[model samples]
Target: MQYKSQAVAKPYFIAAIGLFVGQILFGLILGAQYVLGDFLFPAIPFNVARMVHTNLLIVWLLFGFMGGAYFMIPEEAETELFSPKLALLMFWIFLVAGAATIVGYLAVPYATLAELTGNDLLETMGREFLEQPLPTKIGIVVVALVFLFNITMTVLKGKKTAIATVLLIGLWGLAVFFLFSFYNPVNVVLDKFFWWWTVHLWVEGVWELILGSFLAFVLIKTTGVDREVIEKWLYVIVTLTLITGLIGMGHHYFWIGTPEYWQWWGSIFSALEPIPFFAMTVFAFNMVNRRRREHPNRAAVLWALGVGVMAFLGAGVWGFLHTLAPVNYYTHGSQITAAHGHMSFYGAYAMLVMMMISYAMPILNGKAANSNKSQVVEMWAFWLMTIAMVFITLFLTAAGILQVWLQRVSDSPLPFMVVQEKIAIFYWAREISGVFFLIGLILYITSFFIGGDKKETA
Candidate 1:
């Protein structure tokens, strides 16, 4: 809101929230399908729904990240965006490409969609998360390149700050790592080995840098903390993130036909992965305690704090739970993985984006903070969605524990389906939790429309 070009981020944020709603709705469908195998049946099979759910998550988060960058970069650099027009152009292009891809997923069969989109040319289809068609993949690269160019140029044209520098690194790394998706080697082991370059390295690696930058930016604004102190903390957090996360990639390599040495390396490094997150928790609270001013965007402040605690719990604690080779051997690809994934993603990236929106949206709409009435609603949405996710993770963790016991650790191992039947109760509980998440999402969307007297942070 400080720069005219920053107005462009409003659309990105709006579109992000829109797509987020779609993601959760599909998530509900997926959850129900788990409990009722024939819930959607031929119309929308579980696999298709699952793909939509996960893909939507990636796309929406990308939108949120882009929006956050557009909003924050200019202020950090003390300049307007290099090309607001180009930013808006790429926004439409990315949105269309994302929509078309989702339509293809829902309308045609996966194989048919792949064939139509020229999967035979490069054959990057059907990977777990990298399932976008060739053209969509290409479109992504184009959009990302253009977006990065704009932001980089903007930073170059103005004052450079630590927050902007780290953010750019994270964003550029995101683009660079995504190129691996196009590699798609024929060797299964090699393919998976490189696939983690895109998948695991993203959430656990570069994305953490992006998360830290945003956290620092918000803390500076909301807490009125000294930039020097926050930047120092940012440096420490980033260093820890890279040291821990880069080596932590070995955790995924453990079962991926990698070497035996990975067992010790992965165990040691992944165990230390929680240190950075712990630092983030301390950093958030410490800044708040030393705050020079209380921003009227109390909702945004609450979100900032939530990100620290939840990220520590989800990514730090739960991740360390099954991260070790011995524990992962039993829990790999189990519901426990799902549990960890759900919480870590929501607690870290998702909440970070939401915090950005909560902070920026009010400013974009011409206010220092939302009216107290609206902030109350937004805060309620936050807790409801967050707590709902916690329950979902807990229930899934319960299911995963039972599953590992019955299928792997038991004296008489049961078949997968039998184990699933035994765990159906937990699935039911998770599905119900998904409903609450949806309700919370609805409330979150509703917060945007609720307006009253504007409150000034000053």
Candidate 2:
């Protein structure tokens, strides 16, 4: 089956690039606001910056997933995408909708956006059905469904390989599960309960499947590791991820006034959640070490290896530090949680996606590999961003621990505002470290436009 589609990878690549830039800018804004307090308002408020930060992370990761799918599906299925034109169309529509939604978030206050989108209307009336989280939730559902349909149909028509098929099914599950959050029950407890259906399930659940498959795809292509070896690791990683993560959702319910049983359930399962990430780290490095062929794209290899190590530190180590109910009793909603979230997402997911893009760029552009010079620059960017983020996480973790001790554990607990004042230095340090991250992003964006040397020359 000869599969030919105009490289669908390019658009998704561009989208990923745009979102990466947006994320860095938003991160800087968020960091500055933390230190400067009254910085970049009206033009870019703190809340707005935060919204952009979170939303851009999700969007760009999705873009990476989509692009990776486009690149991998044809090879795995042994056939072209079912509808290349439809895939292209969905790309544009999603981009436009995502941009409009971001604008809506910035242009109007949260309350106003809710009202403008009829979320408050439904809430005010007896219906209570359309609340603030509803319209945005609906938009996400639509986008997820569209993406699922495109990917599923393509897979259905093509050859079925373990890696590609797992990703396809995983993404389909991700889309379907996200829709459950829209019809949140009337009970506040239940609303919070179901909210994790989308948030926890996607990130910690099916998205792990997506990430595992993506990592395996890249490793297999770049390292020329035995297919059997790589696929086995992928299977083991996903199996462990699912076993621990599904039950780990109970962690969120710990302080939400849910049943007491969740104390044990959440803590135990969440504590065990790091095992798979540890396994992933081993998998990536072992494959690279056992590679049968050498690739000139050392930057991509470095990023892949970094993803593993960082995932261990960010997701495994830092996450377990607070997963226990005893520790979380004080650290909930503190900067410690923020620290873990930032590094884990960037290290495990974002780095993996970036590695995929870097690996795919050569294949998509019909080049054997990127130039040593550009690869070196990108590798530097990776190290810079990775190191800066590590510093940010550590500082925030310290600050969070301080806040928790001062507010929750002190002899005479300080007021929250007073605690903020106490931690002001840490915030300043975080902002300064974020400057390094921004610099790394600038280097990364610049590398894309400035073409790399040919593989033969390199």
Candidate 3:
């Protein structure tokens, strides 16, 4: 809203939410496939639905991070965007590529899609999360390079605030780490081992940098906090982030054919991974408590705080639940991993983007905040979605524990399908919670259309 170029972010935000809705829908499908076993049957198998669900989540969050960057980078740098035109162009290219890729996944067999997209030449198919064909992976790299250029040049042209700098590091690191996905060695064990280089380093390392920068930007705006103070905190926090998280990559090594020492390294370091997030919570609320201005966007403030608390609970507490090697020996690959992925991504990445959208969208719409009624509705959506996710996590955790007890720890382990049958009741409960999540999605989408009198600006 501070500059004309910021308007480009609106489309990105819209697309993110649209794809988010799609993700939740696919998620519901996967939840059904878990219990029903034939809900979609030949049309959409569990794996296909899962791929769609995860791909949509990734694409939408990328949309959000891009949107958040496009919206905030210019304002933070105190300049017009370097090239709004290029930014807009990249938007379409990325969107089209993402949507087409998804269609390819659903329309034809994955094998055919891989063959059609030239995967045989590179053999990047069949890997978890990196299952995108060669061309799609290359396209992603291209988009990332262009994006980094756009943002980096813009920062050099104007102010280089700490928030912007941290975000730039994050974005750059994201591009660098993703390249490891292409390091598909003939050795399957090595391939999966380094795959964590892309996955774990992302969520635990670079992505946290992005999350921190976004959280700092919003706190600075809403809390009327000094940039110097916030920026200094950004430095210390991200430093510790790297210190703890880079080593935390060892956690994933437990499953792969890595050395035995990783058990100790991963367990010790990864346990410390929660500190920065907890610091983030303190940082957000502290800034708000000392606010010099009472921002009219009470809903935005709510979101800021929610990200903090939820990130700590989801990423910090839940992650530490089974992070150790001994505990993971029993619980690895259970629904517990599912539980962790859902909350951590939502709290850390997904909600961070939505929080930025919440803050910036109101300003973009020519108001300090939405109508009080609109904010109330948005908050309602927040609680509904968040609380439902909590239930989902709890139910999955319960199922995972039972699974470990019945299958892994017991003297006579049940077969996989048999154990699944035993846990069908929890799946039913999870499906019910997912319904509430969908209802929240509906309410969240509906909130944007609810118009009310704008808050008075002095």
Tell me the whole-model lDDT of each prediction, alpha carbons only.
0.94, 0.81, 0.89
Over all chains combined, what TM-score does candidate 2 have? Answer: 0.94
Residue 151, candidate 2: how far off, in angstroms?
2.0
Kindly indicate the candidate among 1 and 2 with the higher TM-score.
1
List the lowest-lDDT window of 10 residues for candidate 3: 449-458
Which residue pairs clash in candidate 2?
Answer: 77-159
Model 2, runs deviating above 4 Å = 1-3, 120-136, 451-458
lDDT of 1 by residue, 340-434 (tens): 99999999989999999999999888889887878899999999999999999999999999999999999999999999999999999999999
Top lDDT model? 1
- Name model 3 segments beyond 4 Å from true: 452-458
- The CA lDDT at 249 in model 3 is 84
Q: 1 or 3: which has the higher TM-score?
A: 1
Which prediction has more favorable lDDT, 2 or 3?
3
**Ranking under TM-score, best-scoring first?**
1, 3, 2
